[model samples]
Target chain A: MKIKKNIAISQSGFAFDPNSGDSFSLNPIATEIVNLLKDDKDEQFITSHILEKYEIDEFTFQRNFDDFVQMLKHYQFVE
Target chain B: MLPTYNIAITGLNNTDNPGPGVPVIRGLREAKSFKVNIIGLAYENLEPGIYLDGICDKVYQIPYPSAGSTAFIDRIKYIHEKENLDFIIPNFDAELFTFITSQDILSDLGIKTFLPTLEQFEERQKVNLPEYGKKYNVQVPNSKALTSLSEINDLRKEFDYPLLVKGKFYDAYLAYNPEQVINHFNKISAKWGLPVIVQAFAKGTEVNVIALGDGNGNTIGAVPMRKQYITDKGKAWGGITLGDEKLLELTRNIIKQTKWRGGMELEMIKTNTGEYFLIEINPRIPAWVYLANGAGQNLPEAMVNLGLGKEVIPYTSYEIGKMFVRYSQDLIVDLSIFEKLSMNGEL
Candidate 1:
């Protein structure tokens, strides 16, 4: 999915599109994913990094991480 | 400045509402160009949404009447006296009825409301609905606005299986055959206390077009969309964003023809004949306004700004392939219903 060029990201997890004049506030997990993408983190790297940092069990984290990735794909927010 | 142009939105407390009106209000305030204050008014006690807890300027809870038109009218009058609001925007089905019921009273209080006149409101009934669709050469299912249930048996003889028993502003039940039609019709009629609209079911893809009109029927911005998922409550649960020049033009023409203002969501079905069949015109904000805002055109904000005499820059191009998913709400409902049916061995 192609991210619109005019997309703006705030450190506090607020996303805005200057082209549309629309804004979205991302939850903590969504914020993390988008931020990681902005920093050019690959899927494997994001997953492994999250695994080491969070206290969640591997199965739960992987399921949620995968679901979020699918959602990003669904909304055309990411490739 | 202008005391922030006090604005109040009714129906924020409705159960299972997936509206983005509150979010749009917050976004406008964040811009800080204009002094905009949002007062979320609710008839029922609801768990406070994200906006109610200080994101908006204030949150006012209004107690609605238990029953009848008198109770509804009294609640709006009460809200007006308590808030001294500049303008009021009704956000749900019930509240729309309330606003329309007491529009003149609200106007007398110097509270600006952007909806059609009482005559226009009455004219948008089932009998007149199909005519509007026909004028644009849009297909509409065979429907009759019946005052009595006896008319159903007569109409069913001509029209075949799979009919939709619809309320002018309430419930809609899909009745597969004559037996089901009688059952659904009686139930809905008893509940809504209005003439029921019996329509032939059109099996096709569902699409929606929401437009902002200038009250003269000139549309400022319109978004054409296709439903990706539908909740059990018949709300558009998810949608794939698409736009058509022709669809937008037709929508504008209809609104202009009707002299419609405020917000409207036009429901359509893309039929097998490659035609879009007009289903219903809901004269208020829809559940999918969030998708429209996400793609482009912050409709709620645009309408509020336009109401305030602010110049709203028009945008023609929007991202075409975007989609929106509400998650948890849609997902849970779909799963739970299917699970129950499966457990019953019905699926």
Candidate 2:
């Protein structure tokens, strides 16, 4: 999945969907994932990259990553 | 020098179905008696009021009341210790129960709240409105709370078609038949839980009165308004205060009988025949509370004074024809404000 081009992430982690006129905030981790997604990174690539830096194991991080992606989908922040 | 009062208020969600927090804060900010600090307690990270400028001194995220009173009060206790919050006015129907039950506990921590007693709150519920009307000698449509889908059967025998299917806290739909009744029954129940209340629909103009009682069988302030414009969600988009004696008298009589404490909004139907039927009683301040402030009754301020054990006199007069037209505008907020509130739960 990819973060939509219309979705803008600010320096302090605020996400604004210009089309929906809805704004949201992300934690540091979410900010990183969305940034990677915006750069056309796939979920597998994003997961591996995050796992290299954070102290979480692959399985737990993937589960959380999937859930957060689903939330992004639900809010139409990603395509 | 006048002592500045620090107050916390909930219902900061100023969306389509708005909350009373901003308006209540407006009343406090405009108070003649003292300087004020507005503390916003919000349930969502994006409750709009948290982002608005000149509204709140500090905004903190609190656990939703559905999280239960223990967790709810613990969050308040933490905020109280840090801010020395003197008073709180919880403005959501879904949250009133938690706040009311924790009134004594908060008072022990030196935080004051003026709210309806538990008995008063229960008696004015939608399911009990018929009996409340009978007790107060007012008019009310027949209503019954239904716990199951089977209970929808034979409702027409007691009432008629085109009745109101209502949830305990919010949402209402007009159902023309049993099938439609069941449809709304499932929908509202899923959101607000049961027992879903069914009331005989009354056709008329809806007039609302925002009232404050001194908890002493005295009507402190009452302002009546007629909705000249309503939104698709059934919220009044624009309304004007009315100089209706009958409406004010009904408000006075109800407050006298109930000896209601703190703020309440009386939703009533004034039929074409000039009869008034009490529909709903919101135990806390209404979203239209700023309209009351515009009309000359500073109720939230009075509530703070009363909670502080000070004397307040009843408001005898107000200027009518003041209009409130609600509009939405996007406030350009810094990303750090969102970052602070979403991450730390405070801003």
Candidate 3:
């Protein structure tokens, strides 16, 4: 799933969505997820990318991603 | 005219070290003007370890026979009279037993002891988060403390899988499904006890705030931060976080109600609900005491000073976005295991 809108991330990891007005600080991993979402990566591609990068196990990574997506939806930044 | 006061830290022998003893020793040594003594069951020879290093003026070991008996009070009394000690600080959970058991009798020994009553201790050790969260206006998960395995079966109708089974003051295991939750619950409870807190797993960033409180519940000092990395044992091996005044205020409210004097760690999770959920209360110094000191509030030192009736130094705000990496003898072991698990890239 894509972010479907313009997203700006500062060097310090502060993220701003022009459509949502929900300014927040993202940890490094969260920032990477935002970048992928902006790039329109599918769930499979995102999972593979996260698997290659973080030390988390697949089961945990999947759970975390699902949670992260839920968070994004809660923040009204994703559909 | 140095303010000569003798002090002691009990339970300096807990396995979690450079345990609380190391910091207590260091604080006493740094406060060189005060006459301090080290006392403990000597789990690691910490008392003399610090004394020989000149951290304290005297180091005394409580005899084994005296421990957990009436003779124990005699031991502390002997030291109190001989040294004119101002206060006795219980360092570990086990030490609290002695002080609480003989609190009234020890009060006559002319040395002040800092501890909550037995009931207070048990109440504080509870895994009930929802009750505390709502009572204090701190957001927490929709959760319940389960006392029996049967309770989970009853709770299954309301809560979903991937439930968080948590030890009140220690560790947590995330079970992805009800079956897994039950399995982990039975195995862990056999080793520990319940009611284990069963809650909807919060898939969000977890952050913690560590602070010192006066027995009346006012905050003495605070350090708020987010965990960077966690070990399988549920210890934060490395973390990067910033301090927040709002978080500190909420903590202050909790302590006031509890009259929780001493060191405390409050865990909060920022959830998809767009709110921060207060999770648990640990009434002890966290493993990251050094990090809090780095953040400009030396909590151990402040606690020591408070015990002596000294004016505490004001705390300054810590840098935002600052990070800390914790290195320990145990972390080395976790790294070896993490290395093997690294092949799969998930733990």
DockQ of each: 0.03, 0.01, 0.04
Q: Per-residue alpha-carbon lDDT of model 1 for A1-79, expressed as tens digits?
A: 3354445677798876432223578887778878888777777888788888888788898898778778665544553
Clash pairs, model 1 backbone: A1-A79, B217-B256
Segments in model 2 whose C-alpha atoms lie over 4 Å from true places: A1-79
Backbone clashes in model 2, listed as residue pairs: none
- The Cα local distance difference test for each model comes to 0.66, 0.88, 0.64
Between prediction 2 and prediction 3, which has the larger lDDT?
2
Listed in order, each prediction's TM-score against the native is 0.69, 0.81, 0.66
TM-score per model for chain B alone?
0.82, 0.98, 0.76
lDDT of 2 by residue, B1-347 (tens): 88898899998899999999999999999988888988899999999999888999999999988898999988998898889998899999999888889888999999999999999999998888989999999899889899999988879789899999999998889999999999999999999998899999999878899999988889989999887788887898888788778889999999999999989999999876668888899898999989989989998888888889988988998867677899999989898889999999888
The residue-by-residue lDDT of candidate 1 on B1-347, one tens digit each, is: 53466788754532354554554455445443456767666444332342244444555555453366676666556656766777777766555666776777777878877775665665555667777566656567888887776776787566777788887676788887767777877787787765788888888767788777877667777888876677777766666666456567778777778878778888877654447778887777776676677777677776776666677765466666467766542112345534533353121
- For TM-score, the strongest prediction is 2
What is the lDDT for B271 in model 3?
A: 61
Report the poorest 10 consecutive residues by lDDT, candidate 3 chain A: A15-24
Angstrom error at residue B45, model 1: 1.1
**TM-score, model 1 to reference:** 0.69
- Local lDDT at B170 for model 1: 62
Q: What stretches of model 3 exceed 4 Å from their correct place?
A: A1-79, B10-18, B32-35, B43-75, B78-85, B94-102, B116-122, B272-274, B313-316, B319-323, B329-347
On DockQ, the candidate that comes out on top is: 3
